[model samples]
Target: MEYIILVITFTLFIIIAKDLAHHKKKNPVLK
Candidate 1:
């Protein structure tokens, strides 16, 4: 069960990271 939760959390983290990266790319001011 804990492993499943960990995997879910990791995927969520990756999704969030990708979203943030996309946002940064869209708005150069963030850099």
Candidate 2:
């Protein structure tokens, strides 16, 4: 159970990071 939770959290973190990077590329003014 603990291992499953860890994998979920890690996946969410990577997804969020990619989203932020994409937004930055789309809108340089925001950065």
Candidate 3:
């Protein structure tokens, strides 16, 4: 159960990171 939770959290982090990267690319001012 703990391993499943960790995997889910890691997946969420990757998704958020990708979104942040895309957002930064769209708005240079964010950098």
lDDT of 2 by residue, 2-26 (tens): 9999999999999999999999999
Of the candidates shown, which would achieve the greatest lDDT relative to the real structure?
Answer: 2
TM-score of each: 0.86, 0.85, 0.89
Mark the regions of model 2 whose C-alpha exceeds 4 Å error after superposition: none
For candidate 2, report its TM-score: 0.85
lDDT (10s digit) by residue, model 1, range 1-31: 6999999999999999999999999998986
Q: Write model 3 residue lDDT over 1-31, tens digit each, in one string.
A: 6999999999999999999999999998987
Q: Which residue pairs show backbone clashes in model 2?
A: none
* C-alpha RMSD (angstroms) for model 3: 0.8
Clash totals for all candidate models: 0, 0, 0
RMSD of 1: 1.0
Question: How many residue pairs clash in model 2?
Answer: 0
Question: Which residue runs of candidate 3 sit more than 4 Å off their true CA positions?
Answer: none
lDDT of each: 0.96, 0.97, 0.96
